[model samples]
Target chain A: MTVSVDEIGNLFARREGTQRDAAPVLIGSHLDTQPEGGRFDGVYGVLAALELVRALNDADIATGKPIEIVSWTNEEGARFTPAMLGSAVFTGVTSLEEALAKQDAQGITLADALAQSGYRGTRAVRFQAVDSYFEAHIEQGPVLEANGTTIGVVTGGQAIRWLDVTVTGVAAHAGTTPMPYRKDAYFAAAQMALELEKIAERRAPRALVTIGQASIANASRNTIAGKVAFTVDLRHHDDNEVDAMERDLRAAFASAAKTRGVEVSIETYWRSPATPFAPSCVALVAQAVDALGYSNERIVSGAGHDAIHLARYCPTAMVFIPCVDGLSHNEAEDALPEDVTRGANVLLNAVLARAGVAATLNAK
Target chain B: MTVSVDEIGNLFARREGTQRDAAPVLIGSHLDTQPEGGRFDGVYGVLAALELVRALNDADIATGKPIEIVSWTNEEGARFTPAMLGSAVFTGVTSLEEALAKQDAQGITLADALAQSGYRGTRAVRFQAVDSYFEAHIEQGPVLEANGTTIGVVTGGQAIRWLDVTVTGVAAHAGTTPMPYRKDAYFAAAQMALELEKIAERRAPRALVTIGQASIANASRNTIAGKVAFTVDLRHHDDNEVDAMERDLRAAFASAAKTRGVEVSIETYWRSPATPFAPSCVALVAQAVDALGYSNERIVSGAGHDAIHLARYCPTAMVFIPCVDGLSHNEAEDALPEDVTRGANVLLNAVLARAGVAATLNAK
Candidate 1:
């Protein structure tokens, strides 16, 4: 029950090592869940990290570096917003003040919720130079299971760019206005979305585009929309490709609007560059899997993880086990017990290699 | 204050003529206004009709048929489900019970609103074969004014069709789903709207199309939409042209969905067939305008009028004066004073001819 919370509500349980002066090796995922969330999506990673520490104690193995198991707050961002808030704050990607000031659907600020939940701690989030970082998670997609593989040595994460688009047109009576005289905002928005999709397909196997959300302001069944706003999400394996895709998207929207005599504006809301994990950290994970003789495949993560933030400051890698149907973030998400054990074993050995074994344990 | 309300809330003010046994010549328009309505749209028609009857009495001219002025309920449908509720019910276009049961935004029934306003009456709506019907109104468009004409003999009303469209696709993480694997609903909906515009342009100067309302269900700024629903408003001067346009629209939507690997459904929500006023009624009004030496032109009404319902069971026609900038359903609607007087004079002479001036005004 000894849990220490950081200012942004991240929790950590520390396991002391023999070398008290050394920076700890961090191992964690997130603890928050989606609304219709699975039981093992995030819980498995935290539990496995704790189990790894227990196994070391049982075997009387001593490490030179401390091991700290972390549970990042609001990783799902389902209740609040901007998922991975705790990791983003701890890694300095976002300020702690901004993270705490974020509000939920009920108009309650993150700081307020943390205080109400009694998880707001006096400790500030200060990043000490870490030995290494590792995250174990269920493969949220069907890549691993479909391949008949048990473990995934995650290589990197996809880059993402979010664009907010606003289209403005003249609002008139839908029945009375002739088509030639209308500058319809919804029509322009539709064209923008279709063009984005085509651009993605033209660069297929690499670029991905999605018109995630769109809306006409004060929409009614009988009134022509005057203003429409939507969001475009573009992802690719390379940062330069994403930038090119975004430029194409912007030009397409401008062209559509100009042809229709409407107005359009595009702005970037978020951008996350592609992240390739440290080669040494990745090799250590791969060596552990090979030693354990577990079937494995090299894979790239499509979904964002706390490891992305940690990668900004230290050596970081991830391990993934197969999930039933490759579905995470859903209530029906499931993972096999044996696969879970294998992923934990990979995590245990990878953590050990980075947090070196003490001479006492080596002698034994 | 001496008005009488029917079961469906239509208000009637009857003036006794010399002959009590003959059918009355009905003359009026709606009294309700649009949410952002003009000062003289429906009010001008009702007030002008009342003034016509008062002039007949002041001139000491008797008529064989009585004159009844009406103010139709919910004519704007701004506070109800359907417009022209009163006239539609009175002329048997819609059932009295159905019109009475229509609800407003707050879930308040038309019956309740009528009751709350103390206008719900016990008087039963009885239709008697009328001698003739005449409606005087401001032309809510620029045709007559733009051409330097003062009066418009409204010969007919345009047919209208409303189609509800729904698009279905797979919802997924906007950031994770690949372009080839995703069936985004908004994209399909956008393509449908653009295709409809093309279809409308192909049948230009005859058929009109407008996408009035659209919505994406479970919309999120970062999640691909699974379902999108919108309404299409189609209009034309001929029923056959409108029918052809609708078929083309449906085919285009189905094709868009198929090509995009999504599902689409189009349903009709409302329809109003084109109405051509009785030739005899139109001619009598034309002759009166000619005799009065008013500059006039025959025009088709772009918007719905109460006379459209009256034309179903009786000889009916409309007289229109120009509105400033051809704008109605707006707060800036304006009409010239002389145009109003001229329209009233046309109404006076037209009513005189249909009701048969009892040999008194005819001799004078």
Candidate 2:
């Protein structure tokens, strides 16, 4: 089945070129979002793709292959998880059963959600078959806003790490169990998080640490925590930095265990090393953005993307457009229509330049 | 029925005090624990009272009233909700019907548990009738450990603020949800904890923020957390610090809500400001500790105590000794028998100094 941006009126065109050697540069973005989220986040990227395609046609230029556009299903996972339901299927990191078998807060499964939405597609974007993947998105942070950069030519994406660390203690009444006599796991975890932040900040400009998930067992206002479990998400552009942070994290945790006289165990959920971008794609985009008179910056992406997933099997590159306050994924997420079009022009020009298409567009 | 250390002995005991404030200072502590808990935690404080009673008798001092030593039924609440189950019942915070109605992990209610153990006493110390209250316990942290001080002669008990903060975000697939598009509650809560720690630490020494209880709405290894809720225990020895910390905590949370594009609601469980000991109670303990050749350094108690609850009705004082490695409520919870004895001796000497006692050989 062919894809199309119904709302933006952008047509999803298939690459006429050979799948790999004469591969068509794939362009797409997530189309779903958080329920109360900003409309511009996912929508902007989709519209940008449409604008890029329209500009290519306007120039009356064609490549050896056709570029495919995508609207990844459940990109927001608003209804269920393992989001990017369509793209994950395309990448094959997860199976269809795992992706579609998810249940929402109300126990509605993703398969049912997809069926109800009337947008479930049958075809997939096989990665081994694609030449390169590209996507445009909001910076999601204040970096682009503070720096006034218009176009970001991503050098690479940061490594991602997920962990669940549990420290178990004895639960007792808070009032009756003398503090000196109580093993309080919650206190130790809190102190560790505070100290861990320092470890990240000291290595800042690159290092980032987040305790994204936390919980305590047998928790009550009047009771000492019996067990505390939390997930720590630590990331950086460098693998060594990520490793060092993890090591330091373990040390801090062990020390806390010793101090609190509690037992601790850490479970790793996912680990991906920092992935390098398609070098030639990055160079081409850098060249194109400079030619287009938009300040091009070789930025390291803080947020992970589908391009990273595609990088495993094929060449991958990412496009970043300035977002207002660098806001994203919220109802307040916004970027001027002008900046978006400017970004589309850069994306269009960059793709054309890379794919050897002599194209021009009135993006401005 | 009259209560004694031996009648409740093994079941629970107070190390007994030599003197009793006419309506004997209703000294209390829990007798049960989660199987792995430390021994000296709840046990030692009660022993301190028993020992105090013993010392007063040895000195042939008599106060005008009958002294009662109590080992409350199931103060640990390991199998139930509040560790101070007896005290809660005594203070009317929980009715005997309610206390008895509650069930343990094994589905045994307090009444059933007590009935099975055959230790429910017909007599309960009238909380309002006590002349004054004094409890000697081990200081749970390095405040005394790092200081080489033998006593945490508390001038005031730290104020406690409990809050349950919930972050609402879209639960999506971990692999597919673009970091910016997913409003992960776990990530949001973790960041919130880190920031809360920062705000507290910035306030320093006084703003003690500990996240003691936490939970995710639905837990999964791969799910982008749909919702997460955690308990924040913010404390300080100063009332203003409590207010300031609460404000900073809420403000930091607001920023997280805005940044993460999620809804955040904080439910306050309780807010108790720094409670000072009655000056007379503080002075008596300070003098007694110094006279007994223990360090007279008066410090604030980091953990809440029965004295805090008792402070509501009667003048109360807390005498603290050091726990080995500042550890408590764990199998690893080891305190020198000598320290336990010394704590009791201090309590003995202190109570004798306060209420005056008749002949006794009271240390249980």
Candidate 3:
């Protein structure tokens, strides 16, 4: 076994295979967690990978391909933005220099933190040849627990789009302005928010919309709102459907503004296309869940994960165990021990399925 | 004429009457303006009273009853809250001690400010007697200008009601939470705002409603809103109508909250009843407008004023001229010079009509 830390602080433990020249099967997840996050979110996945290696060593099992356990850096983006920085750099989605230069709220760069921790290694940041990748993580949602499922074979991540909407009107005294004479920006924004909900409702179970932030400029209890700004988060499993939702959102906002005699401007600040895991990898995860006799369902990841980046370069899939109440990024986030163990077992079997056992081991 | 300053900083310029024992006719307004206010607003009313006195002097006219021009203090409430403090105290609506104890944002008490400015005289703050009260000021609205009228004979002040609404729900990840599983507070608040508009619309041209301030708790662009707080301002000429509107607002908000699976609480924090000016005083202003051959219309004061308090104890009416774009309490607030002069002329005639000219001046 050999241990190494990549330039971007991704920790890796490698066990040589019977056929050493073959590409390694990678089992990876992030170790970093949100600032106020619970104990089991990111660390559970990293420790699960470590546990898989320990179990294989105890059985003296050998595979045709080498197996590598990786713990990626800065997956939460709590201290630094643009989460999954380690995976993003490893997949070449973001440059090594850019990831290193990312700064936290205190203005400390990722490079500075890595160097201070003595984990900034000389090894290359980018991934080389990989046979397949598998990850185990908490579901961070209510679906699995609500449906009484123990394991989730995650096939993909939902597409997400963020919009900034600004509504402009004329401020006037709340007492002096008659109903017909007002161009109330907050009222127009409220209408747009309701319209966003309707658009999401039309698409039913798969579509989601949120108006998480809203504010009136120069807010006063006795003055009509002159300007209002709010953020819209829209998500769906299909990119085309999310695009359709965005169109509906924009049109509805424009119509509401027109009705209120106000002006509206929408900016699509960030967008991430839907990510679909490889079919063979997904099938392997499902096969593992079935072989283990665990109650499971094929689910799409609603939140971003390191696996999404790996899926771009290699056949990849995920195993999800439900956290209690679907709470993450919070201090109270929790998952049942039995569910966690079941998820880890599924991940181990999925990786083994992708990297075949040695002929000698099969004969034994 | 002799000038005097009262303990609460109200300034009075008194002209001896032909019948000295008769109650004096009072023409008064505030001299203070909003922090960011333009040149006119409060100062226009104060100077118009002075102009009326000068015009009578120029015409060598004397009145049977004594006449007084007054300038009230802290009417803008920019520095101290509960506006129209001086008049409120003078008319016994608010105690002088309470008015003196009011503090500015800088923590300076009104009493301290008056003392520092040498305007806190030994005279009592309360008004003893007055034949009638009149004020000339900017309309602070678009109505008069839109109608191309020269004067607005303000008949009464509107009833006003302020409400604080809070919507509470459960916050969840925007991406992970499906629409059916979520309780979004902002969406609920938005629905309530639209309902407020609908209620106002039902009451038509006279009723006014505004959601002037709104905010989500712990706002994040990618998290479902858990709580929202907002202010509702409702106004109408009739107190009964305003009360009815409040009921409508509460019912609509509760319905919307129930529909969204959220909890809503509404607090009627403040209310001011409708005030009707003395019929004889309103008639006097109308007669003056007609005698002066000025284009005019009857108007309800949609905003608060010192005159509202004075009407409790005296026959009170107001004369208003159009301001530019209905702008007030802002640096850009403006009024045409001719409109200002015409408003002052109407005020002069109204005061004279109430406090009849002496037989000697009538003969002249």
Ranking by TM-score: 3, 1, 2
Clash number for candidate 3: 0
**Which tens-of-lDDT digit does each residue in A194-225 have in candidate 2?**
66766776786577666656777756665668
TM-score of A-chain in each prediction? 0.92, 0.89, 0.96
Off by over 4 Å in 2: A1-12, A15-22, A124-128, A176-180, A358-364, B1-364
In candidate 3, stretches whose alpha carbon ends up further than 4 angstroms from where it belongs are A1-4, A15-23, A115-122, A127-129, A358-364, B19-23, B115-121, B359-364
The residue-by-residue lDDT of candidate 2 on B93-178, one tens digit each, is 56667777888777876666666667655554344466677777777665666667777788878787888888898765443233
**Candidate 2 docking quality: incorrect, acceptable, medium or high:** incorrect
Residue pairs clashing in model 1 are none
Q: Candidate 3 has what TM-score?
A: 0.93
**Residue B22 of model 2, lDDT score:** 42
The candidate with the higher DockQ, 1 or 2, is: 1
Looking at model 2, residue A172 earns an lDDT score of 56
Real interface contacts reproduced by model 1, as a fraction: 0.50
